[model samples]
Target: MPQAQQLDPDTFAVRHRIVLVTAWLQVPFLVAVALLTTGLGQAELGTIGAVAVVALGATVTQSIRARAVLASVALFAASAVLIYLSGGTIEAHLHIFAMLPFVALYQDWRPLVASVGFVVVHHVGVSVLDPEGAFNHHAAQHKPLLWALIHAGAVLVTVVGLLALWKVLEDASRATVAALEQVEAERRRRLEDAERFGAELAREAARLVDVSGRVGEVAGVVRETQEASSQRVGELSRRAVDASRAGEETRERVGSGVATMGDLEQRSGEVESLIVLISEIAERTKLLALNATIEASRAGEAGRGFAVVADEVRNLAAQSADAVDRIRETLVAIRQGTTTTAEVLDQVEAAVDGIQTVQAEVVAVAGEEAAAGEVLAAQVHELTTLAGSLSGAAGTMSELAASGR
Candidate 1:
């Protein structure tokens, strides 16, 4: 979660190391300043220089910039004060040169100026105590003037160079701030555009919802109409089938009657022939009776019994004749019935043929109806598949919309 501005302890330590390295490099410079201006004993100079080096080492290790600067300045100021209070010699003024390099070690101008002031004060104090040995001692100290000029020039150049570096660093910091601000502004603009797009998507989704509702209503209405039409067609077909069946039954009954009439007509012809044969048998019986009467008269006393037999034969012949007359009357009725049946049979046969034709037509109509139904079913199945495909497409769109959201 750390951003670009976040500084870790290691990074901070590394920056401090840079400052420490710069401070360490100035140790030689401090020794040079002491050797160049001071003619003190080697032991004292070496002791003071060793102490200065120890102070620089402590300052570099401290890691606190302000503390490091102040400590460095204090060490050099103490050395100058010590040298000045010990003797009224120009050699003690050499410690003043340590201030310039020490100032260069710090980033802040306050610490640098403070350290420079300390060095200046040390120089003033030395001049007051030993005016003849000071760099401005009657303006005739050639070696001190030369050393002063060199130190002053070096100080001026260090201050100017540090100030210039500070200016460049300040400019770069300002540019970094400006660029960060611009990036934040662009990010805000993009967020606003995303919000606008979300609002538009919501409106479009609402519109699609309304359209789906209307389409569902329309589909329901169409389904109802289709069902009603199918029911009506079914009813019409059933009625046609019932009428056809009735006609077929009527025709079958009529044909059966025609066959029965034909049989009755043939039976009537047989009855007529039997009636004529019975009449011939009656005539033969009458003749046999007459012959028996004549034979009885010739037999005298025996003829009486024969005469009785003759009378019985005549009675039997009369009964047979009555029976034949009744049969003849029954045959006449049968003949009349046959004639009527024949006429009805002809009508029945015509009706049967018409019924059969109607049955054929009904079968054809049923076949056509079935074929039409099959076609309609096929169309309905295709539409159902299409609807399923459309539903799948809608589902995909919904998933896409959800993902986008």
Candidate 2:
């Protein structure tokens, strides 16, 4: 299809056709006017017919713009000449109105003025050439020169009026054409702007879509990470509980060892006391033997044999007491050793209990940390997904915008 601007050539061609058709239409009017006028016989009709045919031929052979002026001039000259030869008549003068519209279309006022002048001159020429017909002698000469002049003036004014009306119509047409062109230009500009904006929107949409996709991808990763972290945390929590239980068992074992050591220390102290009692009994026996020996000595020789027996008994008692004293010392040393061992075991047990407590605390902390990590991972995943979704939406928008462009 031809664009609106490109239609101008076609429009001009159509207008030319219309002008040709209008000019052709004037031929019949010319013939009729000739028939109804004075001094216009078959000869005048034939002459006008030939001229009209030639004008139509010229219009068909050439372009409208080229032939319209020629036709108007030729027609005007012929009419004037015929009127001069016929000595003018009302029918001849009135027929010139038909060509006025074509003259206006030609956009050349000269042709219209010439045609009008031709008619006016015909009036004056008729009065000079044939006074009877020019002054309306057929009406009993009742119309005077003033009346004839007034009649000519009326024709002149009518022609002028036609020219004015034609000019106004042409100006209106031009204005309408200009306004249409402006409207078309504005419409084209708006279309371009709309396309540009649509492309921009599509790009934005595409960007959003890309972002959303990335977010979705990130979300997926985060989800996976979160699940893994949760599993790990749960495992760590169980492990930590196991560690705490192990620590408690170790503490209990240490406690049991400490109790056993305390019992051993108590048994050692009892043995030390038994050794001290044996030593005291041996010392009293020795003192009693010594007193008996002294009494026997005062009785002289009879007591000699008794003193030997007492001395032997005294030596045995002294040996027995020394043995008890050494045993007591050994028992005291054993009790001290047992007490030291119990104190060392107690310290070890306390240290083991402390290590177990620390291990339990570490396990508890690990569990908490693992749980926290899982939560953080979940949140990160969600955020990444959201960002990806936003990007995706942007990308889609961009595509849509691009398509619009």
Candidate 3:
């Protein structure tokens, strides 16, 4: 067999089934045509028996090509037997040509040629050996060889034409089978590509989902930090304002204390002047008492009592002068202390002013920090939103990938 004849299993099976069916049909059709044309005669019975035997043999054959050849030969032989039994009727001869077309199903020229050879051999052999049996009484008597040649010629022509047509059909079938195989191969390749693409898509989707999850986590952390920073900044701003106000109040109190210390210094000066005047008065009184004692001493005995009183007066005056001197020293020490306290108050006021300046700067910085924190929070929120969108997109992609798979 040629490579073209070796069909795929399904094609071979289909052709085999068609051949079997045609065989069975041909046998019955031959018997019916023989019986109808010849009536209950020995020739009809013989033809029917021969067809039955051939059909049985073809059916029992195991090899596909053998069975096909047997069936083809049998069909042609049965047509020949029918033509003989029908007294070489033209209609019966037409059955031989009809059987030729069925041989094309085998897709091999061998079966067709076998069938043609069977018909040709049977026609030629029967005509030569038993001319009376091969044709009707009239055909046998009138130029039977010529008529046989004519019939053979007609069969040859039909076989040649059918062979040509069968060749065309076989070529077309081979082309179709080749095209179908190519199509099947392309389809398989495409399917494999699709599977690979789907697998790659799935992996990409999984990676995207993982990245989205990480980004979302980072966004959450940033948002949380922003919130904490905003809160801290707000608290610091409030405290800074409070500290600034306290600084201002402290500065005011320091100014008042300095003023009060200045007044104390002025009062200490007045007390110092009063102590000087008392010291001068005590000196004068002591001098006068001394003079009186001298006058009493000059008058002796009678002035003795007066002199003792003067001496006591002089002692009192001296005591008053000493007390005035101690008072003056104490006042001077108080004035010095007041001057020191005033200097200290001035230093404290300057420190308070510096604190106020520092406090104002702290308040401004705190405000700026709070504003920056709010901006950061807004940015974090935007990032979180973007991360959420990415996560959603990744989830959609995952679902699509899974569905595609």
Best by lDDT: 3
Question: Candidate 3's residue-wise lDDT over 252-348, tens digit each?
Answer: 8877888887888788878878877878888888888989899999989989999999999899999998898888888888878888888887888
Across residues 1-405, which tens digit of lDDT does each residue of candidate 1 receive?
111232246654564455445445545554555556554567546656665655565565554555545555655545564453444344544554544554444445555666666555545554455544445444534444455455456655666776676566556766887888888888788666656665555555555555555555555565555566566666756866776777677767776777787777777778788878888988898889989988998898989898899989988999999999988887888788788877877877787677668766766776676667667656665555555555555555555455554
lDDT of 2 by residue, 300-350 (tens): 899998898888878988998888878877777877777787788778777
User: Comparing candidate 1 with candidate 3, which one achieves the higher lDDT?
Assistant: 3
Q: What CA root-mean-square deviation does each model show from the true structure?
A: 10.1, 8.5, 3.6
Ranking by TM-score: 3, 2, 1
Tell me the lDDT of model 1 at 309: 94
Q: Which residue runs of candidate 2 sit more than 4 Å off their true CA positions? A: 1-8, 25-48, 70-95, 110-156, 166-231, 263-378, 381-385, 396-405
- CA lDDT scores, all candidates in order: 0.61, 0.66, 0.78
lDDT at position 64, candidate 2: 46
Best by TM-score: 3
lDDT of 2 at 386: 74
| Lowest summed lDDT window (length 10), candidate 2 | 1-10
